[model samples]
Target: MLTTGNDTVLSKRATKTANTDEFLLTQFEKAEANLFHAKDNPEGIVNMGTAVNRVMEVELIERLTKPDALRFEQRYMHYFNNSGLLELRQAVADTLTRHLAPDNPVSPDNLAIMNGAGSCLDALAYTLCDPGDVVLTPTPVYTRIFTDIEERGQVDVMPIVCKAVPDNAEESFRLYKETVEDKILETQSAGRRVRALILVNPNNPLGDIYPPGLLLDIMKICAKYAIHFISNELYSLSIFDEDANFQSVLSFKDIPDPERTHFIWSMSKDFALAGFRTGVIHTCSSSVMKCLGKIALYQCTPSLIQHASATLLSDKAWCDDFYLKINRQRLRDRYSCCLARFRGAGITVRKAKAGLFIWFDLGPYLRSRTKEDEMDLFQEILKRGVYIVPGTQLYCEEPGWFRASFAVSEVELEEGLKRIQQVVEERKQKGQVSWSTY
Candidate 1:
């Protein structure tokens, strides 16, 4: 038996968190890490890095926290439901069915509700992967996927590198179906089992939606290899572009392998209720559902939250007409505002259609086409009173790309844009030119 003294004797998984980017960010010495807290800190940190829907708070709050929100009869609830309340699960199932699978009814029995999507991913990771199993995902993804899937699960997350499209007309860092299969085959040849592939629809950082055909092709590839395909449609209803088509994996008429295909969604992104901490996992495999149910005990959302979320989701008319519609319009307006500002400043921002952020090329500002230069630029902007996540942190192959959230209050967004403009001007005056060759 190992001596359980200090953290030095902790499990390897626990020790891994010590060196994680989350840990490093919390330990930043320049300022208190809780700079975003409104209370004690009079000096506000302009947060353009956090991936959240900060567009409409009053409406969401009013809608979710009304007097009838929580069933008062449920106040005495003290028992644990590992798979969550059937009512909540039913609500989610109904909502999903209404949105993505109107033809086929989504059974509540096939769903498992947990605390937020991050925890759901963590549970799924353990349910499917072993200590050395591999999970493939695209580059410049939401960084937390690494922490959620690998920290405890001990899964190796390999990036499927995508080359940047030189032409403005083409999408950047495009994910090809063939490349995914090739990568899986390559990983197998190297003697590691590819247990899973993660697809973030309306992708984080990129904010682009995958066409339905592409999603089906990818699902077929996963089906062929008998690997788990985890589709995180967290921002499914957050589509801001009128022309962009957003298709949930459930929208497929014929699922390639219902047992292998799974999906995750959360109130955190779509409903702008990260505080509620509600996540749902839908799987057709009864065995997978059993595995998830067993593990979900450790990651269950509170009964109160579950009840409240159920009440919120069950109101389909309000969600469709008021909340989702308003949310999309706000996101569109904010995205347009940010896009116009960047273009006005001659910054080449990859056009985004959905999600809360824009992947912008800061190659022009980097002193050299290097990660170090990227960090230098990042630090300079942070000092100028704005926070944006550098692409290096998101595991992008190339440096000088940055993920910036346009989902902020108008005042805050303008302030952040001003600070960014200042930094860009400062860099330009100092002779920093676009290193397109990188």
Candidate 2:
């Protein structure tokens, strides 16, 4: 056992949380009828609960193999040059003009096919950041990007604090703007050039969409300081409600120095094409795009996935109907199930307009522990057998916040909700002031 007598211990993703991400992979228990546990390693007991069942992990992976997908995958038989099928890239560029662009639609030449968002991020870092540079980002970041920018690229990551508007119907752009402004000023004043202002439109763990105006405000600051703006909009189409859906920065007309803006998109979330591993980096700069292409020339995405995405792009109705409909419904349903259960139990659920998650507020429970690291809440939940990504995985400075993904089926979500409720109930019985609200 490790001791957590220091307050700063919670700052790092330690052995406890690191192993937790791996253990999050689970299987349903036939013996218990309604519990989740490790799939292959029987002795690897991480989490068990009435809320989630792990029995269908194999089946879940199999669902990606629809006959249509097979046909889609087969269309990639004509991979000629390493630039990733010109027709496919063109299709992507055309679809992007419809989906994102305003006046200056991204030409096919401005797009660089990437292995995934990770590759695009790495390419950006390789092109921009020196080892001593500082990369400014908000808390609850894209976890994988942390590795590419900070670990692989060896750049400093400055975390900007984000706050929520209490009692609001949803995410407040006001607070986000305020926090970002403060960080910009602080970094600039410290004689550090914030090389890039990276943002996740629908924040990963928080699951909230930033307002377009907030994005514009951020752009002004970036332009003022000459910092590159990296916007990851992979979950752009999964907004639960239509009004919550905002335009991409690529769609912004008044953005100063449009060439400094880089947009990343993929077929992962909205298409549930998670394994497809398709993404594109779009910009108006030839030099930037050429640099991005060199990286693609080295580590190319799967020829088939790229082919399928291109073909899929040509069929806009499929994107609107199949791709958009499936994920959006799943987003709303899972969100409702999770929120209703948690809120019914009096837990304060954060406001999320879009995305497949609701950032959880475990502040109540963490404050209750009084003398433990944030991992205490995570460990306790695992002992009950519910796997969730701790907020710190996204480089969140606040230890109490955690993420609950709403990407599973409705039935699974309901079960997961029940397990969380069970955890709350058990903690209450122990006379500890545990959390029950959403």
Q: Using TM-score as the measure, which candidate wins? A: 1
Q: lDDT of each structure?
A: 0.85, 0.66
* Candidate 1 residue lDDT tens string, 1-438: 346565467667665676555822542333345464435553456788877788989887787668867656645368766998987899998888887778787889989988899998898999989999999998778888887898889898898987666545156688889899999999999999999999999899899888899999999999999999999999988999999888888778798988899999998998889988999999989999999889888888988888888888888888888888899999999999998999899888888889999788888778777988898898888887778888888888778888888998887788788889999998889888665655
Model 2 CA deviation exceeding 4 Å by range = 1-83, 102-104, 164-178, 367-373, 434-438
- TM-scores of all predicted structures: 0.94, 0.80
Candidate 2 — what's its lDDT?
Answer: 0.66
Clashes of each: 0, 16
Instruction: State which candidate has the highest lDDT.
Output: 1
RMSD of each: 2.7, 7.2
The regions of model 1 sitting more than 4 angstroms off are 1-8, 23-43, 74-76, 167-169
lDDT of 2 at 142: 58
User: In model 2, how large is the Cα lDDT of residue 32?
Assistant: 39
TM-score of predicted structure 2: 0.80
